[model samples]
Target: MNSEEVIALAEQGILTILLVAGPLLAIALGIGLIVSILQATTQIQEQTLAFIPKIVAVLLGIVVLAPWMINHMVQFATEIFANLTKFVG
Candidate 1:
């Protein structure tokens, strides 16, 4: 493919990745922040205190957002495949 086409594909791929992963990452970050604050206030500095909640939040985020994420991924893949002819000589 040409440079512009390659760049477009790359941009679409990155956006798809961000769309799929953004919610879980945001949830994990928020959970970690809250857990850190709680640990600071309560002096319960156990590592698992932060770790477990972030994991749980991410898992829950994934579970809750699975359908949307899958839809985005599928759409992206469909677009890429549909454009496969343009990518080849």
Candidate 2:
């Protein structure tokens, strides 16, 4: 493929990745921030205290978002595979 075509494909891949990951990452970030505040206030100083909640929140967000994420990924993969000849040739 030409440089423009390759760049377009790369951009598409990046956008797909961001779209798929943004929600879960945002959830984890927000939860982590909250946990940090809580720890600072309580002076508990437990690393796992923040870690577990962030992990669980991220997991739950993933579970809730799985269908949409899968659909986006499947669509991207299908388009890439279907256009394989165009990309290769």
Candidate 3:
């Protein structure tokens, strides 16, 4: 493939990664921020205190978003596969 095609493929790969991971990451970030605030206010300095909630939040986010995530991934894969000849030639 030419440079442009390579770049386009790279871009699509990155976009797919972000689309798949963004929600779970955002949920974890939000949960971590809230837990940090609560810890600050309550003076609970246990580092592990934030871990469980963040894990649960990420898991819940994944569970809730699994179908959508899978659909997006499948669509991306389909697009790539549909263009397989172009990529190969």
Better of 2 and 3 by lDDT: 3
- For residues 37-57, write the lDDT of model 2, one tens digit per residue: 988999989888888898899
Best model per lDDT: 3
Alpha-carbon lDDT, every model: 0.88, 0.94, 0.95
**Clashing residue pairs, backbone N/CA/C < 3 A, model 1:** none
For residues 1-89, write the lDDT of model 1, one tens digit per residue: 88998998899899899989888888988998988988899999798768878888888888899999999999998998898888886
Instruction: Point out the higher-scoring one by lDDT: 1 or 3.
Output: 3
Model 2, global lDDT: 0.94
Ranking by lDDT: 3, 2, 1
Alpha-carbon error at 38 in model 2, in Å?
Answer: 0.7
Clashing residue pair totals per candidate (backbone < 3 A): 0, 0, 0
Give lDDT for model 3: 0.95
lDDT of 3 by residue, 1-89 (tens): 89998998999999999999998999999999999999999999999999999999999998899999999999999999999999999
| Candidate 1 TM-score over all chains jointly | 0.94
Estimated TM-score for each candidate: 0.94, 0.94, 0.96
